[model samples]
Target: MFDFDEMESQNLFLYLSLLVLSITFFFQNIKPRLGRFFQPSLETRAKAAILSRQEVAQFLDSPIVKEQEQEQEEGISPSSTFDFDPYMETKVELVNKALDEAIPVGEPLKIHEAMRYAVLAAGKRVRPILCLASCELVGGEENAAMPAACAVEMIHTMSLIKDDLPCMDNDDLRRGKPTTHKVYGEGVAILSGGALLSLAFEHMTTAEVSSEKMVWAVRELARSIGTRGLVAGQAKDISSEGLDLDEVGLEHLEFIHVHKTAVLLETAAVLGAIIGGGSNEEVERVRKFARCIGLLFQVVDDILDETKSSEELGKTAGKDQLVGKLTYPKLMGLEKSKEFVKRLTKDACEHLQGFSKEKVAPLVALTNFIANRNR
Candidate 1:
């Protein structure tokens, strides 16, 4: 009571010192715990952002993002920068040249001419490209699978020739030109198809691969084109003609497409992987990938036929609808068919996981090409 002001000042200094000590202690010890408690950790933050830390890392490390970044640095359009077009063009030219060399204008002019015309037409060469891509996906050179690729293409061309005959789809146009039957009468067309079919096996034998792999590939191709494969699908398609959706449902339609289209594609990829010396697991994985792509190709074909004109498709469009073919569009709505395409594309890409990103790029691009192709 006698020294009230001095006592009050002492008390204030004491309180200030206590407060400073408490703040320093909190900063030194409690701040980290509080920050961790209040703020999410990196993994937790990744989870909050709808991705795992691993997924985030993968996204950061993906080749596509890196490629896009590189392209941007080079002042190129990221949307169109992949160079897949040039890659495909180069492969197509290689396959085309090999095909020309394989089937020269030799004796038996009419049949040879028909085979060359059908095989050498302006086609997309998707099967051969798939074959070559699969070969490369398994640490093999593209040239190693050239013979097998050419054989697959020859078989594909044979199918097209047969499919366009008067006894089948009876189409007058193919690959933006006259159908094989239209250009060279049905009799010659049929003979040429048979010749190509035989030649495919013969040409495949020329591949400088192991005899075991060659035998496996040959058996696969034969099975794919036989009653269990394309023939089965074509038979179902022909039988289901003019039938209502109730009569032949999506299952039947899938059977047809799987056999008619997917089987050959599956064989092509499997052959490439086999001939390329890929392990059994790799070959099977490639088989699954190609199967999805094969179905996707047909689904897109159906959608294009329904939506685009012949000029756009470079073939007879709307023919499936006219014939009441059990197409994806015919059974399911267009939107659903498109959704199916997305699912197939995703599934196809999923099978390519174990392969190197750089090696698998062409196959991945080819998958997208088939899905998005207008023709």
Candidate 2:
């Protein structure tokens, strides 16, 4: 039997849990609302909804933020700001080392080479860094998060390779060099991408956390790339290729961005929180925070594509416009897109209101990075 009553009961329970999480925030900031949504992962019983506008002027401009601002202006505790450069450099180095060690240039040389060539390519390593930061935010050891961090990067690299194949975006340059399919044959790129995807699951299984956490992280990474996550978003985007720009509205755009970009970031934070042994509440908080920034990341990319030159972006610029693909900038002009980015980052900042300011400095910095990065 399907047990419809039990399912309804579970859904009601989830809604109540979400209400509990938001009650305090709702009191201070009535502008933003939260909900409960099912996450398509074995590890996630449910994921919190994204925030609506939270009236940043009312919330972030509180007495506490004003006091901090005064302190910064007076040169008292100027270092209160997060040191994003050094933090990113350290996390990237550690993640690169782990990725290199995980894949060796050994037997079956061609395939291994293809995998390494793409996996070791230049990029921000943002997903892995976010994973490590999320772990440390919850007082977990970096080593405990390393395996999952590496897994996220592996999966991301695999997506890049797949996206660049002839049948897909058909791009020639990624990271300022030829894409995987451009250098290696299409057959090799496909096989190598699959190999990296498989390795992500295998490598995640080696996390130093408890077996339970490891299993949770593994399921998260898989779901992030499967039908309900990145693939789902990409499928929708492809289907929308021929639709008129006016026909694609905010709802569809949000859907594509949420599933395609936000899901990986969501899984990264959730996995980190899991390995760090965060309480269910803390994990859900970080997941909600990451979801906003993940969407911000794509919105910024859309803006950059319209505003910057190809040389500045290190790849094709205005490519989204060329393909008639739907983008935030296209759907809502540059000014509105910029406003949307601000709303999202402010909402992201709101999720960390209960965490230690010191512990969440990196996430705060990441929100700024997403808002301001030129490339």
Candidate 3:
């Protein structure tokens, strides 16, 4: 008496029970292992925590955090801590000396003196240093890019002079000193600006790089200050001034900054890369990085203008408000503007990936310095 049906039922039950046990074992043991395998390590979590802030503060206060978080997330660690202050000091000295040599008190001493006054003033020298740093980042020597570096600074000084004219923003102070038009008559200041613009191209041609690279650098520099770049931004800015925010919105404001501010920064980096012999891809990468920081620079400027004192800013603080101009803080609120700063800083640093940490230190440090600068 085989009891065939009962025997079949018993086998089916046994099979079901074993399958259930396997699943339970997987959930209890193997699943835990799998979860642990997928989870990020404590070190990774700690690194990520660098970007977290419990309280909303000005973005400049935590410049190191944004840069460090970006680097650590990419598993990048410099061999040693990068001392940015000394690095900036060295670069500033180099640029200042070059600029002094570039513009001597020659014939027509008034224009040259005005040019020298504006160019040799105590600027952050952000544009020129960016050129040098970018050149070095692409394996070019500093000396090779020195000419272009000085050229970029000259263009920047020209813009500042023109920007402070009675027809423009009409500011009385710049770089902690009287505006160019204030010290020198507006006519002479205007002439000095024109002279610098011409000298910038001439100085750029003096670079010992190939003619092709020199041509490319010259084209980029011209476009930056032309109708396509700074001029475009300034034109829009002047047109939109005192208009209702609804009429001139964030998009409009961004257009102004992208041209008026970021264009030259983009040019500075692109010129450096070209002179440094970087490939097209590397040049574009640096361009993108500079664009982010360029816009970031304006956003930070807006924040500083709203919050810092005139003495603290080295320029007229609250001038944007005084002039009925739109700013990031006015449009996005201070907290949101700060958040934008963080985002821009993050984006800026991310572009530096794939380059050696040591080689890219100057640019990275520059980004942080720009982010955290008090003046």
Candidate 4:
């Protein structure tokens, strides 16, 4: 006899074992390969659009910025008066002027001003500039990227305004000036921040970019600011109070920072690259660079909070410690944290291989700026 029942059971057991083995193989090897294959591998991605260090140094050594820096050395802050030669200075003035003109007047204007105040109050406009520069690096027109840049700034500003609300950081000062709630009253401040949030979408929808690009930009912005990004990160930060986290716990803290800060930055870079007509690979490369730098930026910010003064920082100092927030410096010690920043910056820059030196300068400068900034 064939022993039909026994045979059937044996065959079924064999099939089940094979199925489990297949799944195990997929997870162990095939899955990771598929993930990397579908998305570009970090190693295979193109370099960023930026200038070489020598070229950048030469450019900085040029008469224009040199004269401005010399004036500062001579005890005159160039920004104190306003000089139009250096591209950075000129860009700042242009952004500030646009912000002023864009804000309206009236009952609603009170909130508008508070929103603008948070943005226009003066700090490095690194994010917006990165957006613009990335666009140019990929051969896109600077004008084409301006709206996206502006929208990013608005989104960032709105987040700051909300982050400082009483329910959040409860901060009273920003950039050495009264916070939106302090200056405009809490209700007006909240409204202003809300207005800015809406305005970001408004700017995106109406901007010169294509409908497809606009959609992506809007989606990225929303993702960065919504539950999965800044808000989620903030929630985690608040929940982490007074808990001495281990390495894994600290990683969660890093996750919060990356979501809170890096996602938008990475989005800005990706948007610029896409608008500039960069290859998909190129765009991915810059996105990775942005992610690395974004994390570096936050780590540097934490370190500066410990080392720099409120006067220099233009905001409350030591608030990270006050809030019992886990920071790289707090967890890793100052020197190790600095080393980490350098390594991160190096990793970011390394991803920019094959990119034009002209396009890469801002990226490199950005890394150094974040790593070395005192404020």
Candidate 5:
């Protein structure tokens, strides 16, 4: 009379159905909706629509969007809205002043100029600002972060110089100007990058930060830029060329990017925390935040390469595809890649929720900006 077998089968079927329904619901929510006999139930459709509307509303309410609207009202483009000119102007002035003092007069004028050129080049010093912002978020002084910020910038510049070399990306232009190699000779370019790398350590070692903190910072920086970090990623990236990458292959690409691009950025955030005298736990949390933002940054960069012009992006567009390098857009398709970016941005922002909103505003704004940047 109990019909126990029947009951068990019924429960199993229910669970399986729920699982299928959930999968369907997830796809329907992320993908474009189409009216079909297989369409979700009315309640599911309504929920999906509501979720979509909420996401749109969130995008509209984002500070980046608000700023974009304000700029547009004043006849400025959205891309130009996040103007780095003022920030760059200050950073350049400070960096150049420091370089002048650091480099003795008549000391290999070309090397000095090349160092200055690589450091003072026009780009949004986003990574350095990220370092400062992370420090501030943990109640650290911006002045305390200056040396770390400069070191972060120097490492970043060194990476770029190396990336643009003929052995790597062979990029001819950066920041809308001729690349370091093009402006300077190939040998000089290589030396400039090497000098920048050395100077990053020099700055860190000589900075007034505590000896213990300096050791940690130096070790982390070395780890990030060495085999376990950017160089390893670059090696994998080079190996990926002309290969038909599956999902696993794509993951390798992601790993490569996480190291090649994200590690330095994440390290910057962690270093800021270290310099701020933050606890290890706090530094790791910032590292998580950086990982999310870094991946999102690369995803957005890939998307922009597919959809934007070189003129707008300030470098070669579609080079990833041209070189057969795996990318989010390549593996996930443009629409899904965009959805992935959105998810990553949301996750990145969620990580910052524990921090003060004021101190975290730039980080939040930056994730959104990276997710949506067309160029």
Candidate 6:
């Protein structure tokens, strides 16, 4: 006899899981129209990795990676080697140059200056770097991905501006410097944020890629910032305030983080892959990998908030606890949060298994950095 009920239940569970992941930018109600735009142009895309010194000669010279290579030659730590500086140097430099040009000082001097100040500020450059790295990993020219990469940074800077406002996180410091609102008045800070947000899309439209790919990238970015994306996530977070653990719940917290943080990362990676001309399957694989890392970012943040101090973390430590914000450490124990990060890292790398090993090396190192960074 057929067990129709049991089979149906299993299928339903799988369907809902897929729906949650694929639809909501980060699990809210999905904007299917934008999601469709990022679909790969081909079924398969062949990619190459920087397997030797010759292959990486054009990029920045990474002393640490070179040292590791020397060790390999001498057969030391044969099973252990990783370096991300080369990947970071070119990316950070390029993104900074693009950013410098993206928002120049002009008439309406205050607005432009405010935008330039925040956009050109120092930070980890994580989002744009991810975009460039993803494109390179897929064997695409870094130039083709530069515009979108810069755009990603602009969006990130805008988010920080808003987050630091008295209305939001009320943060005073960022990247070891005063927040935009602290340097510029609240009015200027708000305008600067709005300008950067608009600039992200404007800059993407000007990327040298084909009209089709540019459109695709633009729509994906739109999806990430729209109603069911970052905005929704922020609203949820603010609204969830003062709610009990039982009220906000783990699922709700995850939803908030996914929408707020993960969606942008997912968009950044997907945009890079698409610009790099990845096939449909390859683009999807990268998105899944990025998705895991994006969520992992928040989890590690929660863990750090509990375990590190203000100086070590470069910001207020235990702020989440002080504010009673929902976090992995608060919901799950500190040990459990650490365990969750490990599993997420493992899952992130597993998605890249189909990629060229050499190409995915930067991402691998990046994942470790995110998991273990002190600040």
Q: Best candidate per lDDT, number?
A: 3
Model 5, 238-356: lDDT tens digits are 98777675434445666778877888888888888888877766776787788778878888888898998889988887778887888877776676667667667666666665666
TM-score of each: 0.78, 0.81, 0.80, 0.76, 0.73, 0.78
Which tens-of-lDDT digit does each residue in 258-368 have in candidate 4? 777777787788778877767767877788788888888898998999998888898899998998888878776776676667657776777776676655666666666
lDDT of all predictions, in order shown? 0.81, 0.78, 0.82, 0.71, 0.71, 0.75
Cα lDDT for residue 156, candidate 4: 85
lDDT of 5 at 228: 70
Model 3 Cα displacement at 167 (Å)? 1.1
Give per-residue CA lDDT, model 3, range 193-305, as digits (tens): 99999999998898899876776677678767877678887888888778876675555677788788887887898889989989877987898788889988999999999
Model 3, stretches more than 4 Å misplaced?
1-72, 75-79
**Candidate 1 Cα deviation (angstroms), residue 70:** 23
TM-score of 3: 0.80
Please identify model 6 stretches exceeding 4 Å from their true place. 1-82
Question: How do the residues 1-375 of candidate 2 rate in per-residue lDDT, one tens digit apiece?
Answer: 899999999999999999987986786555321111233342232222422434434532334321221111121121365688898888889999999999989877888999999989878888898898899889999998998898898888888888888787778888777888878899999999999999888888888776656655666677788886889888888888767975866767877878888889878888898898898789888988888888889999999999998778877788778878899878877776777776677767877777766778887787787778999
Model 1 deviation from native, Cα RMSD in Å: 20.5
Clashing residue pairs found in predicted model 3:
none
User: Which 10 successive residues of model 3 have the least lDDT summed?
Assistant: 41-50
Give the residue spans of candidate 5 off by over 4 A.
1-106
- The C-alpha stretches of model 1 lying farther than 4 A from their native spots are 1-82
lDDT of 1: 0.81
The superposed Cα distance between candidate 4 and the true structure at residue 83, in angstroms, equals: 15
